[model samples]
Target: MASDAGVPDPETQSLDADELAFSDEGIEATLSPADPESDIAAIFDALFLISRLAQHNFPARIDIHTFAYLACLMSIYSGQPANEWGYSFSAVPPTLPYSPTLDGAIDRLVETDYLKTSKSTDVTNLAEFELTPEGERELGFFSTLSLLSRRLQFLDASTSAAVFTSSAAVVNSLANEPQLAAATHLNSSRQLLTESSTARLYDEFEALSQAIGKTDVNLILPASMYVSYLQSVMRATAEEATGEAVENA
Candidate 1:
């Protein structure tokens, strides 16, 4: 039950889709793109899409300090390209805003196995960090979680309040409007921050609403849709908890 359409390797790395479908019984449903055309199928499809995007966009690993400072660099160099990433970090030239010093981060990365030390004899600060094979694998997983945390921060910046949809039924209804659903994720994403400084695990989520409207829209929107499913489940659970409290009172 797998599609050969651009699947990444299946090794010690099983960083597959994290969006899961639950039936009325709270059991995860097996998904198929070929099932009957209901909201259920659409929801599963969206989950699958987001998971793929997360896996694909996942980046190399770095410690908490560098992660905290990465937002500045990402926005600063959104469209820019660098032939050498290690030098790129060194070039940021950390300042007194209490930023994670890129130079320091590069050194830590070298000490840890995350980055390999390949000397650049010609240039002064041009250290080469070919992310270790282990780093490559960890990067794939941790990058996804990092991406979501950054998205949450971006969303917080734009909105003073949390947008909580209050029902699973609402989520089911929105699943069909994929574009609109993805739009809900725009506040967060693109910067790749995380809560835990030592975060190295992927969130069991695949879709990202944060990057849904862009040209890479096709790949990310489906993943973004999973947010809808999560929102609905959360809303319903909260409502039930409230109702139970009232009954107890």
Candidate 2:
């Protein structure tokens, strides 16, 4: 007795299943639309911090890389967790991890004339940048945004002399971050820096903040502690590395 006409043979059934699995329509149907909200937030965060830093360092242009480094510090000081923050960086030695998100943010700002390029160079990161008058206006507008009020307050706190004497010191501290050091060590093997790598640092910062108690003036205290912790960790890591090298030698 022959099978029903509508029934597919085993070979035909396999071919049909393969086609459904590999077809462009099938693949596209399984994928979700990209949500750009996170990326947009990241751009806004970068813009706010970069503009504030630029204003802080007015009349003195900084390289793109420095802007990114300082922005990272500002974000941490603003109480953002490492994973929840808007930017990601790769471990780069002698400096803070290089952030492609920040690099793109700078590019967008320059293109929009919110930031001015003082010295154009083949390497965009090496070129000097400062906030434009329009950028200042933009920052003013940002201050009015309800979403940014807390961040603006954090920035204000961080810039006050009570927190740190200079943004330059904050920039320099990036070089000594133990997490960055670990990432740099792994970078040679092409490993990406994971957010978990900085979890301990963030946890410590939170613990310190809780211990300090919350108050208007205390907004900046945690940031100071975070920097101090980074310095201590950096020294310990360097000493350990050096001792190992000596023993091996």
Q: Model 2 over residues 1-249: C-alpha lDDT tens digits?
A: 212332212222121211222111111121111224334444555566556555556312233344344344444534333333334555565444565555666678889998886665786456656777887787677566554444454454444422364666655555565566565656542212244354555455445545555422444565566566666766787799899999999
Q: Candidate 2 regions off by >4 Å?
A: 1-36, 55-84, 92-95, 154-165, 188-198, 210-217, 235-249
Query: Which residue ranges in model 1 land beyond 4 Å of their true spot?
Result: 1-100, 120-124, 146-249
Estimate the TM-score of every prediction: 0.24, 0.61
Total backbone collisions for each predicted model: 7, 0
Residue 152 of candidate 1: its Cα lDDT? 27
lDDT of 1 by residue, 1-249 (tens): 222332212122222233221112100122222322222222221222222222323212221122222222221122111111112121111211121233444455457666564554555243334556665565455445432222323122111111232222322333222222233334321212112211211122212322232322222233234445545655676699899999999
Worst 10 residues of 1 by lDDT: 21-30
TM-score of 2: 0.61
Q: Give the Å error, residue 112, model 1.
A: 1.0
RMSD of 2: 15.9
